[model samples]
Every structure is written in structure tokens, then in C-alpha cells.
Target: MNFTDIDPDKLFSSTDNSNPIMWLVWIVPIVVFMFYGQRIQLQITSGEISKNIAKLVKYKEESKKELLDYLQTNLKATPDAAKKIDGFLEYFTIMPVDFDPNGIIPKIKHLLRSREDYTRQQVKSLSPNMDALEVSKVQNLLEVTTSLHLLHKLVRHLFLTAKKQNNFPLILPLQMMIPFIMEQASALRDAVSALKQGQPIGDGIGPMVVGKMMLGTEKKTITFETVCAEKEFEQRKLYLLKAEGPTATVGRPGDAVELLVLKNKPDIIVMIDAALKLEGEDSGSVAQGFGAAIGGIGTDRFQIEEIATKNNIPIYAVVIKQSVKEAITLMTKQISDKAESVESQVFQIILENTKPNQSALIVGVGNTLGVPQ
Candidate 1:
């Protein structure tokens, strides 16, 4: 056991090379390192993402439950209404509607009618009784609430699935994108609140302008309660089209414009709508361009494009810029104040684009929530 009796080579090579203990000694720490490394990576990548996902999911559930309770208590929704709501919720949650060209308007119309019917039935079951307008407002609120809930639920599901798979690469992009999703969800929540209180949102700027123009003029119903009024502006006959609102609908603008073109054969077609602004763009800024300014499932834009092409009419677009949050939520003072400026810009565009005494069909597109015609 003395230093002189010890041999370094024998001490180091005492075990056979094939010995299992020799392999274990070398392999166990490496395996342990890999396991702990994976855990660390998961913690670093998925911690914030998981927390945000949970927050979003919880918010959606609470919001959905609150809206349902409000419908049942305040709106007096019956069991039948509840079933219909569940159906609507399931449809959206399972298969979200997206932009498509084929028969999208009809599909939207059908959905709207279904929603209206459900709301009507609920209102009918009320003991204290509510008016049709009240029912319409409630229906709109429910729709917004459903959209918000569905959006949050979808994001939460995606995040949870990624986390379950322990996919750090997949999780990074999701984590980066979640803030924007949450922002939109928060805005939608604000929008739902505004709708419940029957307030116009920033996107209603177009309709508000058109509605003001309709005042003191004869309004003719075109389609789906959409109305058009003719007025003379700068020696040209201006036909302004908008949804008959104060209820919640974006009326069938495409159909209205098509009908008007056939009847009046307007020299020019002009459309006004709210457009999403980029980071540098200021809210309420007006931009003039060509083509349909309408935003939806492409049906309306397609219809307008077809009619404009056939009639050889130049289509002009006047868009007011706003952020997504501003577009859906209640109208800001800036948006409201800019309405007149937008109107002036439209007039300028019409005058510059069309010859004097020529007829022009101007359609204001977007939801006419609190805007009256």
C-alpha cells in the first residue's frame, strides 16, 4: 500500500475493457447532461410562451362564460337559444371562416340570418320584453365575443400542442407571434364591450360620412336594407350607398353598386373604407387609390370588380388608415374628427377623377354600427 508498491498503469487499467462498470462510469454523466440540457432548453424557450397561452385561454373562457351568463340573465335567452349559440360556437371553434371567393357573401348572409334568428328567439322568450333593436345589438355583441373567444382558444391550442411535443424550434416563432395575437384579442374584447353599449367603431368612419351625405336626400333601398341617396356635389350627381344601420350589418354593397351601375350607368365608381395602418402610418390618415376598398371574404370585391370592368368604369378607392385595434374598437376622437377631413378628400377625389355633371356611384364600406343613415 506504500507509494513504492503503486503502479500508475495497473491502477488505471485494473478493470477489463469489456467491464460494464467501466462503460457506466463513462456514459452515465453524459446521459445525465443531455437530460438536464433538454430540461433547461424547455424552461428557457417555453416558460413565457406557456404562461401567455394559459393567460389567453383563461381570458377566453371567462369572457365566453360571462357573455353567456349575460345573454341568459339580461337577454333572457332560452334553452333553445343556448343550443343555437352552442352550435354557432362549435362551428366557429371547429372551422373558422376565412377569405374565400366562391359564394362567400351568401354564406355570410346565411350566418347573419341564423344569428339574428337565434337572437330574436331569445328576445321573444323574455319576460320583461325587449325590442328588436335591442336584440340586434345583443346579437352583434355575441358575435364579437365568439370571435374573440375563438381566436384566443385557437392560439392556446397551438401553443399547448407545441409545448407537449417539446418542440423548441416550433415554439420560438409562436412565442414571437403571441404578442400580436394577444393585442388583437384585447382589441376584440374592447370591441365587444363597445358593441354591447351600442357605440360605433373606427371602421364606421366611412359609413358615418356616407350617412351624413344621405341626410336631406331621398334614400332608395337597394339590397339587404342597403340604401343609396343621390345628391349633387360640385355639379356632379353623387350617389352615396351605405347599409341602413344603427343596427349591425355591412349591407350588400356589391349588389347595391351593381344595381346602381345598371340603373344609373355612373361614369365612375368610388369606394371608401377603413384600411389597416402600418407602424409608421397615423390613424385617421386618408389615402386615395384605385380598385375596391372593401374588406371581407372577397365576394364583395369580386362583384364590384366584375361590374366595373363590364361597365368600363374607373374604380377609385379612398381609405382611412387605422390600426387593427382602432378599427374594431370604439371610434376614437381622432377618427371621429377626421370624418369631415375624409369627406373632403373624397369630394376632392371625385371632382378630380370625374368630369363635371357626370354621375358617380360612391359606396362606403364597413360595419355601420352606431352610424345612422
Candidate 2:
């Protein structure tokens, strides 16, 4: 023992073959304990998890109470607002299946029924004197809703078919990232709920995603230095205008987009911007909607949208989803497995629909937040 007296050959040659399963027996319990411990730590550290769940519970209770209040108060629904809510809710409620399936339009159509009475009542509460023009806009919105419904249905059907055919791998790693996916979904659901309640959805997710750099308040002729950063938009008819704001803000809001559309008389407008998402989110979960005209929520998006609405121009928005850094790097592929498809959908809207007299304005909206102008 003192001087390596035991025979070296015997020690090296002899081996004990223990069951490999025995190692797991010792490891698994330790892993389970660690996992449970981490969950407890997470619960303590992230109050929002419990608070959000409580909020959901509170929302359900309030929704029930709202129904009761409507019945008791004889509150009427605002037709336009009701229509918007009903349409949004119809599509929002659908559970996503077949992670890669394309069904946005069909799904909306399937879920859309007659506008809820409560929704109509709420709309009336918000806007009592909604005009004929507003009514027409709501009708147009219904068409969009129908298309969304159809898209969802198509996605579901595609997924179902793929499942039957067994066309995909037996295991997809993307499915393993459920908790992250659920977090993003919950964030979206919460935002929508707040919207329905006319409440704020916080400065965390919404402002990071679709809300920024809103244009349009002063009405005048405007122009941008037309630079086609991406080839897909290059061939399409394009125009550019420059607007400088306070150090903290860049790109005009939605109201500006509307004013420009009316004054410049453009046929089509498109906004290209960087959209922020949670650290780990499904790349494909972009929730598109109407934007504001001036400095408000999603104002940048709204500016282009307002112009579209006012001048009867089609407004298409393409948002590159990334963290602030990734956005600067212009990484085409983000976390989603279907990044190509997402990019294609965005690019197609701008490129495929070009006509002889159409002018498209693509706004690269982001925080010129941290970048040098």
C-alpha cells in the first residue's frame, strides 16, 4: 500500500460490470428533487406567475359579473366595438395545432358567428354615434375575419392530414419547449384580455412587440429615402419619407401614416419594423391588428394602417421579430422553425400585389431605440 506494491497488471485487467440501469436509479431521484426545488424557487421569484393566474381567475369572475351587469343595467353593445371584439375573440380562442400548418383564414371563419349581443352593447357604450362609414368599415372587417377563420381551419386540416400520413419526424424538439411557448401564449392572451377590458397590457410585451415609432400628427407632404434593404421589396414600387423626432423616438406613428396617405395620395403603404418578443417564443405567433393613427399603442403600425383606412389603400406590415441586438444584426432566422415561411408571407404581401399606379411605403420602424440615425 505504501509504495504501489500490488501487481499493476492484475489491477488493470480486472473489471466489475455493474448494471447501467443502477446509475439511473441513483440519478433520477436527485434530478426529480432538483426540478421540484427549482419550481419552488421560480414560484417565489416570479410573483407575476401567481399574480397572472389570479388575474385570469379574476377576469373570469369579472366576465361573469359583466354578463350579469349587462342583464341588470340593460347596457347596449356598441356595434363596431362589438364586431371587433367578436371577430378578435373568435380567432383568438382557437387552440394552435399542427405547429407548421397554415390555417389562419379558415380558423377565423369557423369560429366567427353572429356578433354577440354583449359585444354590440359594449360597442354602443363606447361609441353611440357610430356613422354609416364606420358601419361599412365594420362590414369590411367581417370579410377579414372570414378570411382569418378560413386560414385557421386550413391549418387545422393540414395538421390533421399530416398526422394521418405520419409525414413528420417521430419527435420534434420544438414540442419540448412547451413551457416557453405557453408563456408567450399567455402573454398574448393577457394582452387581448386587457384590450377587451380597455385596460393596459403593460410596458413589457406589447410595446416591445407591435407598439412603437408612431407617425402622423402634423399634415404635410413627406418623403423617405427609398432604400430596398431586402430584395423582395426592391422590385415593388416603393417610396420613402424622412421624419426626425426627439432623441427618444424615431419613425412617425400611425396618425402620421394616415395624414401622408391622404396628402400624398398613395395607393398602398407597407411598414417594415423590428418587433420584440419574449426571450423564447414561437416565431410564428404574430398577432396582426389595426394600429392607431397618432402616438398611442402600436402607433407606428397604426400610422400606416390609418393611411390605408382613410385613403382606401392597402397597408401591409412586416415585422422582424428579435431582441434589440438580433434586430440590428438583421438575422433573418429567429427562434421559429418556420422563419422562412414567416418571411415569405411578409414579403409576398408587398411584392406579389404590385400594380402600375401603386405606391408602397415600407417603414423600418424600431427604436432607432438604440441605433445611431
Candidate 3:
């Protein structure tokens, strides 16, 4: 009752083990956490990760199903055709040694070309009646399916390893990455539909602009799957280069650029493509800068840069901004509608940069899906 009357000995004494409330309040929690805390936390974390992994699996399976359906319904292929594609999904290529880093682009390009041929051949063999356009579509669709499959496999592998090792730290990175992984997988899933329909994607904005420019002009094949056409604007000769399309292919623009540079001795090289927008940047916004502006395996960019630099030509770039998702998925009305403005910008760049009798090379660098030469 009084400050000095308290029992000092009782305050420091051990708890009464006989009291159930004390055990429930302190001892029980201490014992549980000391022994099974990680197990409980693991179950909680694993449950969340497993839920996302299930979604990833669904996306992968759906893509695979779509491809099989396309094979049967469109190609009129046998059921074994689906099996062949399933086998193809696991195909991979080893990159050439980059230790020296010289002449690696050619080796990389060769390996990529071989892989592309193999992919096209596999799709072609199943349906000899399918045209080149059909083959390109099927090949693109197959790539989307294969990418989803690989993502699913990689995520599952991480999940299993974390579970097996009973290590929460090991799994934390996967947890952090699941959102990005799912974002990409969802985009890949959306792409399957566009590829199946042979619709243009945001990336096609580049080609769409140039394709419109090349329309009603005399066109010639400059390289594999690439075409070039010439036009006169003001007093300058504009040589338009783009992937030959209405098919899902980004042709060898590098070779096309090299050939054109040597042939015409263009005063400037301008490359246009769809670029990824920053977090706050408006989609479909047009931006211009100086560079090759090509987005791919970098071989094209290298070639474009090399030839432009060697010829003492200034390289200019005009880009339409969009997200990776938008670039690969269906061409949004916003992007498709922006092509006209982009074309105007290209013409302006040519007019302001070059003079009479000077030739300008313009490259529409992207997957020219649904955009014809």
C-alpha cells in the first residue's frame, strides 16, 4: 500500500509455473517462437508465393493451349504437331564466346539466324500448305509460348529450392521479383492473341509510318525480309527501309542499311522505332534524338552505327514511346494513330538536315507485323 512497504524479494522472484495464465501469456509464446517460428513464417510466405506461381502456370498453359488450337484449327495439323511444338519449346542456343568481344556480333548473328531458320523450319514442316505469312505468325506465337514456359519453369525452380532448403532469405528475392515476372508473363500472354490474329503491335508503329510512306512507290528487296523504296521530298531523295511485312518479322535492317549507304551515299541515317516510355512519360509520345534507335539483339544497332560512323554520316532517331507490354501486345489506337505525326516528323527531319541532291536513309526498325512495304 505504501511505497516503502512493497516486498522487494517477491518482485524479483521466478514466475509461478502453476498458474495457467502466466504460461499462456509468456511461456507458450516463447516456446513456440523459439522452436517453430520459421516454420510458421515459411508457411505464410510460401503460401503467397505459391498463389502467384499458380497464376504464372495458368498463363503458360493458356498460351500453350492457344498454340495447339491454332495448329489444329488453322493449320489443320495432326495432334502430333502439338507434340512437336512442345518439344520445340525447350530449344535453346549457346551464345558465342564473348571473352574477346571482337567479331562477336557476326557469330551471335549467325547463331540467331540458325535458330530462326530452325524455328521456321519446324513450323513449316508441320504444314507445308501454310504460306510464309502463316509460318511467321506460327513462329511468333510459338516464341511467346516458349517464353511463358521458361518463365514458369524458372519461378517454379526458385519456389522448390526455397521450400527444400527451408530458407526464407533464399526465397525473399523471388518474392520481390514475382511482380515483374508476372507483368512480363501477362504481356507475353496478351501477345499470343495479337500474333494469332496477325494484328499490328505498338512496335509496328515504326513500320506503319514508313510503310505508309513507301506505299505506291517502287519497292525492292534489299535484304532478307527487308525492303527499300525511294521517294522525293522537296529536293532530297528519301530512301525508305523497313521490314517487309504484314508478317511478324523484324527483318535484317542492318544489312539493308549497309547496302543502302554504299549504294546511295546518303547524307544522314535516320532510324525510327517504338521505345519504352519512362514512368511518367506519355505513351505514344514522339521523341527524337541521335542514335541508331533500333531495339533488338544489338547486331542491327551495331551495323547501323558502324556504317553511319564510317561514312561520316550523322545518325538521327525518331521514336514513339510505349511500354514493353504495349510494344509487344496489340497496337493501341493511341500508338497506331500517332504514326501520321511520326511520318511528318521524319519528313521534317529529312528536309531540315539535308539539301538538294543529297540522299537521306530512313529506317523503320521494328517487328513489322501487319505493316506492309
Best by lDDT: 3
TM-score each candidate.
Answer: 0.80, 0.31, 0.90
Inter-residue clash pairs, candidate 1? none
Tell me the TM-score of model 3: 0.90
Q: Give the C-alpha miss distance for residue 186 in model 1, angstroms.
A: 0.6
Ordered list by lDDT, greatest first: 3, 1, 2
lDDT of 3 by residue, 71-187 (tens): 888888765797798799889889888899989999998898889888888898877569989999988988898999899899999999999999888888998998889988889
Better of 1 and 3 by TM-score: 3
Write model 1 residue lDDT over 245-267, tens digit each, in one string: 88767888988998999999999
Model 3: how far is 324 from its true place, Å?
2.2
Give the worst 10-residue stretch by lDDT in candidate 2. 223-232
Point out the higher-scoring one by TM-score: 2 or 3.
3
Which parts of model 3 have CA positions greater than 4 angstroms off? 1-38
Overall lDDT per candidate, in order of appearance: 0.78, 0.39, 0.89
- Clash count list over all predictions: 0, 53, 0
> Higher-lDDT candidate among 2 and 3?
3
Give the local distance difference test score of model 2.
0.39
